[model samples]
Target: MNQTQKIQNPETNVPKTPQMNERDFVNDQLTTEKYMTASYNIALNEASNQNLYQDLATIFKETQDCQRNLYNLMFKNGWYALEQAEKQKIDQTYQQFTGYKTQLPYNVQ
Candidate 1:
């Protein structure tokens, strides 16, 4: 059957989808991870107890791992695109930051 005929057929076995697809779901989770990571950082900073801070820190690392995994999956699926920065640009940034080193009170020498 032609492509149009398959789409037009009401008896087609195509599964009904919600407003959001798998990509959208992953994107939503990615956004949630950002907020969750931020919240964890804030809580960890405000935590006065060492044990509580350690627990929050552990959870924060897990959240970061989850975010990284999701990013890798999205990149593999072509849902995410990352542009490579030129070496010249990276060198320029490095030089800019390194220039501030002399401004410190103590000398490296």
Candidate 2:
């Protein structure tokens, strides 16, 4: 069967299937998780209460783990393709960022 092909609904003409719907749902979940983790990090930094910071930190770790699991699952299923950057490009980026440290008056520990 051509599972990859999309078929339109006769009534509303909305093209979708079980597999595609699930894939979309997973993708949405992954995106939501990413946004949530970023928000958690920001909130944690701004948090004044120790208890609140601890709670947010815990949730952040869990969210990060969940995101990693989702990424692994998607990669395993061929749903996600991660392209590898060239070593030269990576080295160039590293050098560029490293040079920014010298430009700043404040030293980064």
Candidate 3:
């Protein structure tokens, strides 16, 4: 079908579901709020515990360091890939311009 027809009759075969009742929706929202409040209280309690918080902080710092190292490695790898691609493009340009029979030496060795 063309774009206009498809847009006008998009997903015509799909069945529409019934909407939720107001009472049920309100009850779901209240339950979600209660759970969130409980979770906050638990987090506050954990934070107040000095030993637990100290251990958590150490673990968080280690995790942060690990993530930083991973990011650095990935960034270096991406840079290396881009450098290789640029070198390839330059080599192709040089070969086209000079009519070289073989690729130019990339290194001294």
Candidate 4:
């Protein structure tokens, strides 16, 4: 069938979504707020804990990896959001940076 016929007979092909009621919307909002509050508290507690720093560090590293993968996928497939030159510049800068390290300078006797 042609595009117009397909559009008119969408019920046979496309799935139907249920409409949300006021009570359902309120409940969803309440659940979202509850989770958000819990997450915020967890973050606050972790921020204050020394052991949690390590866990946070690991999470941060993983998040960075995920972001890099997404960037590569978006740009490599000609679906890049930014200009190619800008993307290349960012890639070069990231490559040039080394991770943080601690080293004390030698003291004269």
Q: In terms of lDDT, which candidate is stronger, 1 or 4?
A: 1
lDDT of 4 by residue, 1-109 (tens): 2222111211112223587744344445545555555565567466967778677666655555555665454444433334234555667776665221222254323
- Runs in model 2 with CA error above 4 Å? 1-20, 106-109
- Give the clashing residue pairs of candidate 3, or none: none
Deviation in angstroms for 63 in model 3? 0.2
Please list the C-alpha lDDT of all candidates, in the order they appear.
0.78, 0.77, 0.49, 0.49
Structure candidate 1, residue pairs in collision: none
Model 3, range 1-109, lDDT digits (tens) per residue?
2222111212112223486644344445545555555554455456977887776666555555554554444344332122233555668897796755345665332
- In terms of lDDT, the best-performing candidate is 1
lDDT of 4 at 56: 66
The reply for model 3, stretches above 4 Å from the true place, is 1-46, 79-109
Off by over 4 Å in 4: 1-46, 84-109
Give the clashing pairs for model 4: none
lDDT for position 91 in model 4: 75
State TM-scores per candidate. 0.76, 0.74, 0.31, 0.35
Error (Å) of candidate 3 at residue 37 is: 22
